[model samples]
Target: MLNFFLVNRLSSQVRILSSLLVMLLVFILVTVLVKVDTSTWTMEFFALSLVCVAILSGASNVLTASVFGVTGRFPLQHSQSLISGQAMGGTVSALAAILDLTIASNVTDSALAYFLTADVFILLCIAAYLLLPKITYSRFFGLFSYYMNLPDEPTDSSSSEDPVETVDVSSSKTNSPPIIPILKKVKVLAACLFYTFFISIIIFPTISAGIESVEKYTGSIWTNKYFTPLTCFLVYNFADWSGRQITTWIQVPGPNSKMLPVLVFLRTFFIPLFMFCNYQPRKHMYEVFFKSDIYPIIFITLLGMSNGYLGTLSMVYGPKVVPKELSEGTAIVMSFFLGLGLAIGSAFSSVVHLI
Candidate 1:
C-alpha cells in the first residue's frame, strides 16, 4: 500500500488518509457491534467481526508506522516521544477496560461500555485530525511538509558534476534488487523489534489472564473478583509507561546499538516462567513457585519495562543507521516487523492452552 503511494507521489497523505479511514471504520464497526445483541449473534458472525477488527487493527499499525517513519528523520527524541505516547495509550485503554469490567452491573453492560468508549475516542481522534491542517504553524503540518519535500533517494556526491554517471550507478543498483541493502542495514533493529513484541504479546492478554493470585492471597470480595487482572494490568502498564518516560532522560542502545537485540531476545525466558505460575487452567500441573501476588507483580513489571525500553530503543535507533532518504522506509519496516512479531506471538498463544 505504501509502495503504491510512494510510487505515485502520494506519500504525503499516506498517514493521515489511512488513519482517518481506520478511525471511521472503527466507529462504524463498534456502533454496529454494539447495536447487535450478542445473544442473537451467531458464533460465526462474532468471529467474522473479530477478523474485521483485527484487519483494522493492522491498518492502524501501518498508520503508526507512517507517523513513526516521518518522526524518525527528525531526532531520537521524537521517536521516543511517539513510543511513550503509545505506551500511555495502552495504559489508558487498560484502565478503561478495568473500570468497565469491575463497576458495570453485568458482562453485557461492560461490553457495551467498552465499545461505546472506543467509538467516542475514535470520533475525537477524527475531530482532532480534521483540525490539524487548519492550525497555522502546526507541527503536524510542518512535519508533513518536511516529509513531502524529502528526496525520494539520497543525492550522490558526484551527481552535481556528472548526473549521467549517478543515474547509471543508481539504475545498476536497482537492477540488483534495492531491498537487499536496506534489509542488511536494518537487520539488527528489525530483529530487536520482532523479539520485543513477540515476547510481550505472547504472554499478555492470553497467558497472563490465566495466572491468578493464589487462593491464600485473597483479601476481599473485590479482590477475589478483580484483583489478579486489575493488579497485573496496572502494574504492567504503569511499568511500561514509566520505562518509556525514563528514555526521555536516559539514552542507551541508541541507533544500531548492539545491546538492544540482546536485551530483547533475553525476554523469551518469560514464557516458560509465566507458564509455570499458578495459571487458572494449569494450577495442578506445577509447583507454582510464583504463587504470591508480589512474585508475578515484580516479574510483570520487569517484563513491561523491558518491553517499553527495548522496543523504544529499536525504533529510535533504526533510522539513524540508514541514509536520510531511507530513514522513513527503515522505520516503516521496523513497525511492520513488530506487527509480524505480534502475529507470531498471537499464534503461539493459541497453542498455550494445549500445554
Candidate 2:
C-alpha cells in the first residue's frame, strides 16, 4: 500500500508531455508575433497574449492540484506539495523581477529576460523528463485505479455473516452528502469573484502606482531593484502563514479554534501598511508646497512589509476558500482581474504623464 501510494504520488509523464506541448504552442505563437508583425503589436495585443498564457498556466496548476488532491493526504503531505508549488512560484517571480531590474539597469536587454524565461521553462520540462525515468507510469496508473476502487470510509461490522449488509449501510452513510455542499460552493465562488474584483480595483493599481513612483523618483525603470525580490520573500512568508492558518481552521477536529481570526487580523494589518509606505510623500509635497521634500524611508519600509502581508494572505487563503475543483478557474479569474487592473493603472499613469 505504501509503495502504491508513493508510486501514485509521482507526477505523470502525460502531464509533463502536455505541459511541453503547451509551451511549444506558446513559443510558436510568440515567434510568429515577433517575426510577422513587430511594429503593429499594441497593448491590447499584449493583454490578449497574457490572457492565453494565463489560461495555459491555470490549466497546468489545476492538473497539479488535481493530482495532489487525489492522493487524499491534504494538509499533511498535501501541504508540503502546496508549499513546494508556492516556493517554485516565488522563485520564478523573483527571477522575473531580477530580469526586469537587470534590463532597467542596462546590464541586460528586455529580450534577454524574455529568452531566459523561456529557456528556464524548457529546462523545467527537461528536469521533469529526467526525473520521470525513476517512476513507472504503469505502476502509478495501477495504484491510482486501486485507490479509486477502494471505499472512502471503512465498514463497521459486528457480525461475520453480514458483510454485504455492512458494506451497504456504510456506503449509504458515506455517500449521503456530496463532497462539497452547494451553499459552500456558492460562498466560495462569490469569494473568488470578490477577490478578483478587489485585485482589479485595488491591488494592481497600487502596484503600478508604486512602480511609476519608484521609476520617476529613483530615475530607474527597474521597480524590482526597489521591491520585487524583497516583496516576493515577504509575500511568500505571508502566503505560508495564510495557507497553514486556513488549513488548520478547516481541518481542526474541535470547535474552540482561534487560528482563523488571528490569521485574518494579521493579514488585514498589512494592507494599510503597504498603502502608507508607497504614499509618495516627496511628490505630494513638491506638487502642493512647491519645495524640496523629504522621503520617508520608514514609511516605505512599513509599506513593503504591509504589501508582503497582504500578498501572502491573498495568495494563500484566497485559493483555500475557493472550491478545490475550481482552484484553477478561480486563479484564471484572479489573473483576469490582475490584467484589468494593470491596464487601467497603466493607462491612468500614461494620462497623468501626459498632463
Candidate 3:
C-alpha cells in the first residue's frame, strides 16, 4: 500500500530509479551479511534480513506499477514482453538457486558471489535507464505517453483543422483526471488480476510446499532432499515462464471476453486437488487421494502456467480498457489490485491452516 501511494505521487523515472537503487543496496547488504558466520548472530542476521526483504518487496511493488504505467503507453507487445521477461527472470533465479545448492561447496562464498553478480546487473540497468532518454525508441514512447495524458478537447463539428495542432498547451492545469471512472472502466479486469494472484498465493508455498514425494520408501536423495526443489520450484518456474512465452504465440480468452474470467475462476479447483496430494502432517484433511508424485508434478505445472497466462492477459488488458488518456492511471490501479489479491490470499492461508 505504501508502494502504491508512492507510485501515485512520484514521477515514473524517480520511482523506477529508486527501486533499482534499493535493489542494489539489498544485494550489497546480503553479500556482506552472508560472509559472517550467521551462527553467532542468528537473531540479528534473520531480523536484518527480514527488514531488508520487506523494504525490497515494497520497492518491487513500486517497480511493478511503474512498469505497467510506462508500458501502458506503448503498443501492446511491449507490455506483454515486460511480463514475459519477469517470468524469465524468475526461471533464472530458480535455476541459480538449484545450482548453488547442488554444486557450491562453500555456501557462504557462493551466495555472496551470487549477490555480487546480481549487483553488477543492477548497475547495468541503472546505466541503461540513465541512457534511456538518448534512445529514440524510448523518447518517442515517453513523449507519446505524455501526449496521451492530455484532456479531451471540445468537439467542433465545423472546424476542419488538424486537432493535434490545436491542443491548448495550458489545458493540463484546468482538467483533473477522473480516477473513479477510470477505475470503473478497469474494475472487471482488475478483479481478474486480483483473483488470479489470489488463487496463486493461497495454494503455492502453503499447500504446495507441504506436498511430498510418495516414493519416500526408496530413501533416495532425489525423493528426499531434491524432490521439493525440482518438482516444486524448477518445474513451476519453468512452466510459468513457458506459459508467458506461449502468450506471444497464442492468447486465448481474449481481453474483454467472458471466457477470460471464467478460465481464471476455474483455477480455484486446483486447491482441492493439491490438498488431497501426499501433503504430510494434515490435521484437518487426512485423505491422501493423490499418492503418486505425478499428480503434484502435473498440478503444480498447471497452477504455475495458468497463473502466468491468465495474469498476463489481465494486466495487458487493463490499460487498454479505458481511453488512451486514462491508461496510465488504470495500469497503476491494476497493480494495486494485484497486490491486494496477494495480501488477502496470504491472510486466508492462515485460515486454511486452521481449517
TM-score of each: 0.82, 0.49, 0.88
Writing each residue's lDDT as its tens digit, candidate 2 over 1-355 gives 1111222233334444555667657665664454444457687788978887886765455344334333222234343345345445654665666556555754335545565567567667667655534446523434333333433334334554422222332233213222233224333333432333343234333432342233345655334344534443434333433443444234432112344334334433433433434334334323322121122233334333333333333333433443333333233333333344345545554433232
lDDT per residue as tens, model 1, 21-97: 77667657766776676676689777977887777776687568777776766667878898998889889977877
Best by TM-score: 3
Q: Please provide, for model 3 over 45-78, each residue's C-alpha lDDT reduced to its tens digit, 9 standing for 90 to 100.
A: 8899899989888888888888678788788888
Select the stronger candidate by TM-score from 2 and 3. 3
Candidate lDDT scores, in order, read 0.70, 0.40, 0.79
Off by over 4 Å in 1: 1-9, 106-112, 130-177, 216-219
Which 10 successive residues of model 2 have the least lDDT summed? Answer: 288-297
What is the clash count for each candidate, in the order shown? 1, 1, 0
Clashes of 2: 1
Question: Whose lDDT is greatest here?
Answer: 3
